[model samples]
Target: MPTSATLAQPAAKPASRRGFLASAAAPLIVPGSALGLNGAVAASDRITMAAIGQGPRGQFVLGHFLEQKDVRMVAVCDCFAERRAAAKQVVDKHYGNSDCAVYRLHERVLERKDIDAILTAGGDRWHAVMSVLASRAGKDVYCEKPISLTIAEGRSLIEATRKNKTVWQCGTQRRSNPTWKFVVDVVQKGRIGALRAVTTSFGEGPWRQTGVPTEEPAPDPEVFDYDRWLGQAPWEPYSKLRVRLWRVNWATGAGAIADMGAHYFEAVQWARGNLLELPVEYDGAGMFLKKPGINNIPYFYNVRARYRDGMLLIMDPAPKGVRYDGEEGYIHILDDGRVEASPKSILEGLPDLSKLPPPKGHWNIMAPHIRDFLDAVRSRGTTVSNPEAAHASHVIVHAANICLRLGRPVKWD
Candidate 1:
């Protein structure tokens, strides 16, 4: 889960991409400059990459980039010493390159001129600031899902990226998966016949927290700055789960809705024709499957979104798994390691790549996402989960949270 962080400082005005391109095109430095080997830095050369957050998802993203020979892990950043250490080990084990820098502060990583882009899995609160700041620092960014904490934040990120002309990619990898994309395309093209409703489910609900150890000593102030970690949200005692597992907290993360629902809601938008077009309203509830822990929140969350066009979307925690119901037929989108589509007929004669596109090698599909970002960076083109599409998807998750908070289905205007 991406943890929110306080902004270290406002962003610097980014150098124009055209200026960078012109500088590269000209032989100002000849073959060797301060960094050395100017001509050697071809477009096909290894891209210097960094990982800003090394939690589960962040580590997963790091693993994806390691598979490609054209990329190198030059740096990593994480607030938690343990997570940082874990990520560094993974980098060392997987990266073909021998030496890489690791830092506790993301700002330090952003300051490196050699790093071409960053793989960010920071807390939800940090999404906008980290992404925007990275863009301003002249680095491409591939940040995780639920792109923003608030509607304003989402819009701000878009503006920041546009202003900086950064290559921004969101962690909505399903967009790149051929199978999922086909499902979405079919739904939108009326293969489902007047798509009336779409539903999604995930999670066993929030984990009930046990009381924190009353006398547990705080982590070394030098290693992990607690104040910096809290950022914008109200302060609270640092619990293991609270700091590392911050996704369970409303202040730091979006609970299960923002954590898992972001993916589902984004898919919902993709299925319906409202991804770019906003929704009519969000109606939902965040209720507990168990008692709240140090961070009180619903372990299980359910929601139903109604669009103005009368299309309804229902999503609940995967009852041990997930499936989709369509107007013409139903599709089973599962979490039980099972991948089955509706009417088997849809994929009967589909080609190998068309049907399964190479299992991203990891259960998590973000690897292909990393590859897509690298490709887009070279092509100077938009990726499947571009910033705009991601921004729209985030609104679905944000609206869902708002509806639950307000205890009413607020209209989307």
Candidate 2:
């Protein structure tokens, strides 16, 4: 593994393609389509990109990137051979060429000077570390949610992106949903009156384990690099269940709260106008599986947190989404893009959601969010789900987890 100092060293700048073409001894002819003719974006003008982690979620997001005309995905990296191959096939098919490169290690992808951005959708264990490394390599990042396994890791990612002047967009796609945008607008515009409390739901947790996992022989390195897949996670005996269900394990993932909580919390923060702030106090209780299997995360939890301004936030396993309560009325934003409100009048003046354009495709509701990141990358601007907001959201969940594990209240600084 490379040290932070080594990876953080500034990468050498690469020569521009136009400059190289200009200096070529022989005159090379190129297709008009390659130079932005016939409504196609020019190769030099497109954002050169690569992807790390080609699991189901990763591939899903990669599909969105493929839809963008201004994004050129040149490479993909994954520890699993099948995943990388599948991702490469998709990329190649989209471009009608076999030019998409594949690698098992992410460092190889990061070393490419021509790549301007990276899309990291690996497990929770790899999110922060990979983003930090990509930032150090001068690559903008679009990372999946639950961006860190711990508060410290989240903080490190924020610091690295800031130090490297990287543009990062966390995968909290709800921020781009029209319903959510309207919710934030309503709250911020004081339609809900002075916001007093928020109740957000992140679904149920891991199942209880009944038996211990037996150690098994690891797979061949070519098939799956188990060691690299674990990344910063502690070494554990090779077990298929561990890899398949990493979210239930403490060492590799942070369970339901960190998984879904990231989205809900970010929504809460945005609606409350506290994107850069964290709660000052946290208290929670969790029901952990008493069995001795690999699963250690809680099966259910309820957390109560308070911001410095006395606003209350509650995280629980019910309600299916987020609900904001104010002095006058309350508004509820459901997980399926449905919005409900009390006294009914609070929703009267809201925009007609039915008239807005629907999501592009199945499971591609995040298209707008992805577009936001790519636009920011091109213009050197900030994204809605930027690193600071991501870190703050991660800290909220990690702090709640600590309180639950300690069975005591935790005071934040």
Cα lDDT of candidate 2 equals 0.86
Residue 359 shift from truth in candidate 1, angstroms: 8.5
Residue-level lDDT for 252 in candidate 2: 88
Q: What is the C-alpha RMSD of each candidate to the true structure, in Å?
A: 8.6, 5.7
Alpha carbon lDDT of each predicted model: 0.70, 0.86
Tens digit per residue, CA lDDT, model 1, 1-413: 22212132344578899988987899764333223254333334677788987878788778888887677777778877788778878877774344566677777888777788898887788777789889999889999876777888889888887888788898877666656665666666655467677666666654444344233457885577676677667877766656755666677876666666666666777776556877777777776535335555666567887778777777677653334556776555554334466677654544553346443342366566778899988777877777788888778778877777777778888
Candidate 1 segments exceeding 4 Å error = 1-44, 95-98, 205-207, 210-216, 288-293, 320-326, 336-363
- Looking at model 2, the pairs that clash are none
In candidate 1, position 221 carries an lDDT of: 57
Q: Report the error of model 1 at residue 353, Å.
A: 10
Best by lDDT: 2
